[model samples]
Target: MHLHCYSWTGAGDDLRREGERRPPLPPGDLAAFRASPLPPMRTCDWLLKPATRIDTSPPTVTEAQTWLADRYGTAEPSFLHPADEARIGLDLRLKIAEESLAGGTDVLWGIWLKAGGFICLVVVCCSPNRHADYPCPCRLTSP
Candidate 1:
């Protein structure tokens, strides 16, 4: 499974002005970046070099929410919200709950803002499962 998140800093109007100053991303690398299966945060130079050149700080949940709200607006519903629990498919919720109890990995990636109006992209490659079940998909065993 994979998830993607994006965020920024400063007023919306400043983005266009700031963007003009930065070098553009290579046309070819966009696909590769998307295809890569959650590369480690430390390896985010590809993104940091161009789009988020100003900020080098790590991403935070608060900034992530702010970015989401800014771009998508608060009107649209979110499955992660507790009030929308009913909207979450029963099977998926069950799987998540079971996974929590049994232990499973979580991977995250995103871009976040810094103190000086710069943004940084961060990728949390993987959070290992504390108590995985037998026949774990993340690991291989000799027969």
Candidate 2:
């Protein structure tokens, strides 16, 4: 698998400046991320935000299906099934509310996987107010 690392200041101006001034991160830098506990500091202002992209090796459609089925216990994961979309949306709303109550921004992570003509998108949001819990994979789960 290959991973890409980048950061966003959560502002439009910073994003535009980043596109104009910064080059892509070195592949070795991403490798270092997996081996080291602390990531290197960003040299530019726009590259200091929190975000990342992970790209896995291409897999066959059947492989993707099997992986999802194993991870979620169903061929159709909740994120992929239309019937569960509303529930996901509501969960995000509640998460945002909880974050607001805790004096933190509503931090959300989006995962997009594509391989062998199959695509899956997952959005996991963390609420700053919540304590550590196994079922919640948000970064703020721990104090």
- The candidate that achieves the highest TM-score relative to the unseen native structure: 2
lDDT of 1 by residue, 1-143 (tens): 21123333343234444333332354333333333332323332223222322222224433433343344333223223434534554345335433432332332222222332333232211222222222221232221
Q: Write the per-residue lDDT of candidate 2 for residues 80-115, one digit (tens) a residue.
A: 344554455544644453444234222232222222
Which pairs of residues clash in candidate 1, taking residues 3 or more apart in a chain or in different chains?
none
Off by over 4 Å in 2: 1-31, 34-79, 90-102, 110-143
Indicate the worst ten consecutive residues by lDDT in candidate 2: 1-10
TM-score for each predicted model, relative to the true structure:
0.21, 0.22
* Cα distance off (Å), candidate 2, residue 116: 9.3
Error of 1 at 26 (Å): 16
What CA root-mean-square deviation does each model show from the true structure? 14.1, 17.3
Q: Which stretches of model 1 miss by more than 4 angstroms?
A: 1-49, 52-59, 74-143
